[model samples]
Target: MARKKSPTLTEAELRLMEVLWQRGEATVAEVVEALPKRLALAYSTVLTTMRILEQKGYVRHTEEGRAYVYHPLIDRNQARRSAVQYVVSRFFNNSPELLMLNILENEAIDADELERLKAMIKNAQEDGSEQL
Candidate 1:
């Protein structure tokens, strides 16, 4: 069966989601405090963005006293997989191999990281063979 498509998050929404993902749940003031200082967003901006995230189904909230405690509806790994799938389809013609090749060619992957990647590829190959 095909997987259901998840809603895409904007950069601002993702920032708010990060706070919820890390903290498990938080109030609007908490989210604002968790954000990077460079972002310089006001509490109102964070509250508005989180409300938008709720509308987009990326978050859910419970009322705590007078504040809404928000949490991520989607986990980080799920969001990462969806985002990667989007990039693969849109930019790499649905070819993950092409995407890896581009990254390997252009990015400054260190020796340790390269070895780790190779080990992962080897393990994947072994797993694939076992499944066949």
Candidate 2:
């Protein structure tokens, strides 16, 4: 059987998700207030976007008084991993090594940051060896 495709969030959806992920649960008003000032979104817009998110299974809402209190159904880390996987598959030919190489080549990494990365790679290699 074919696996169901994961939903990819738009920038707007991600903004709302960020609020939910931070707050754990929020009403439409709360979400709007928590949103970054630059977004300047209207209440109706936030409500509609949240409803769309609910439909997409990224969020779930419970009726609270006169408002719906929304919470993320997907954890932030889970969504981040899925987004990274999608990018790796689409833009890096499904190669995480290529993705890392691209980032290391393009980004400005100071000596300290390079050492941290090397340590992380070494730890990962050790963990992989232990698993084997």
Candidate 3:
């Protein structure tokens, strides 16, 4: 049976997409080259993954000479937002607050980072009050 296409990018797909997002466009060889030596992804593996990304509508390709130059259809920020929404829906009962709370509780946040988060929350509350 055929596997269902995931709405969100897989880890492998995200790795390739990060390369595309950084470079703007690249051929399969370029992507393989850009990846860290630790990953050790083969040219064929990168090519196949790029094709999967195309099928998932996250990337498009143009034929340039003998190579197919692939470009990201979505930007990094858009992908991040989609990933966060997916996590919220799948693991937090669709509540972004729950997701935020989990991160605050489980992660070791620095004091400066915690202050920034509190400031952002304060700004959000002010914005909400202004809306009313």
Candidate 4:
């Protein structure tokens, strides 16, 4: 077999992983079913992408009776972090502020969520300071 390039998944892969994460375990059909139309992706394309995900250690699968039960090998938060790192490094040039500002601009965070998000950010900053 050709060396399956690098296993590192891109943003697209991470999105697919989200469906698998939510479902706990899923098959190719299940994942395809979960995708939104704007994804503009074909079933075979998703299958190939997920197989690459398996090769890259982002996902795992077991033979369940006659079906392949696929699930994420990594934690959802960790996968999110990895994808964030990639985007920050590649597009945002490692500036989290840009990403945060983008999210704040495009997404709606209600007051309760805003407060919770603020608390999380403050806690993370404080924790970082403690390590120094």
The candidate that wins on TM-score is: 3
Per-residue lDDT of candidate 3, residues 1-132 (tens digit): 998888899999999999999999999999999999999999999999899999989999999999999999999899989988999999999999999999989999999999999999999999999999
Report RMSD (Å) for each prediction in the order shown.
5.1, 4.1, 1.6, 5.0
Residue 99 shift from truth in candidate 2, angstroms: 0.3
The positional error of residue 62 in candidate 3, measured at the CA in angstroms, is: 0.9
Please identify which of the two predictions, 3 or 4, would achieve the higher TM-score against the true structure. Answer: 3
Please give the ranking of all candidate structures by lDDT, highest first, separated by commas. 3, 2, 1, 4
Model 4 Cα lDDT, one tens digit per residue, 1-132? 776464356777877988988888898888888988778788789888888888888888899888777888898888667767888877777999998988899999899999999999999999999999
State residue 113's C-alpha deviation in candidate 1, in Å: 1.6
- Model 1: residues with Cα > 4 Å off, grouped in runs: 1-7
lDDT digits (tens) for residues 1-132 of candidate 2: 985644678889999999998899999999999988898999999999998899889999999899899989999888889889989999999999999999999999899999999999999999999999
Clashes of each: 0, 0, 0, 0
Better of 1 and 2 by lDDT: 2
Best by lDDT: 3
lDDT, residue 11, candidate 4: 75
Error (Å) of candidate 2 at residue 127 is 0.7
Q: Order the candidates by TM-score, highest first — what do you get?
A: 3, 2, 1, 4
Candidate 3 local Cα displacement, residue 89, angstroms = 0.3
In candidate 3, residue 50 scores what lDDT?
A: 92
Candidate that beats the other on TM-score, 2 or 4, i.e. the better one: 2
Q: Give the TM-score of candidate 3.
A: 0.89
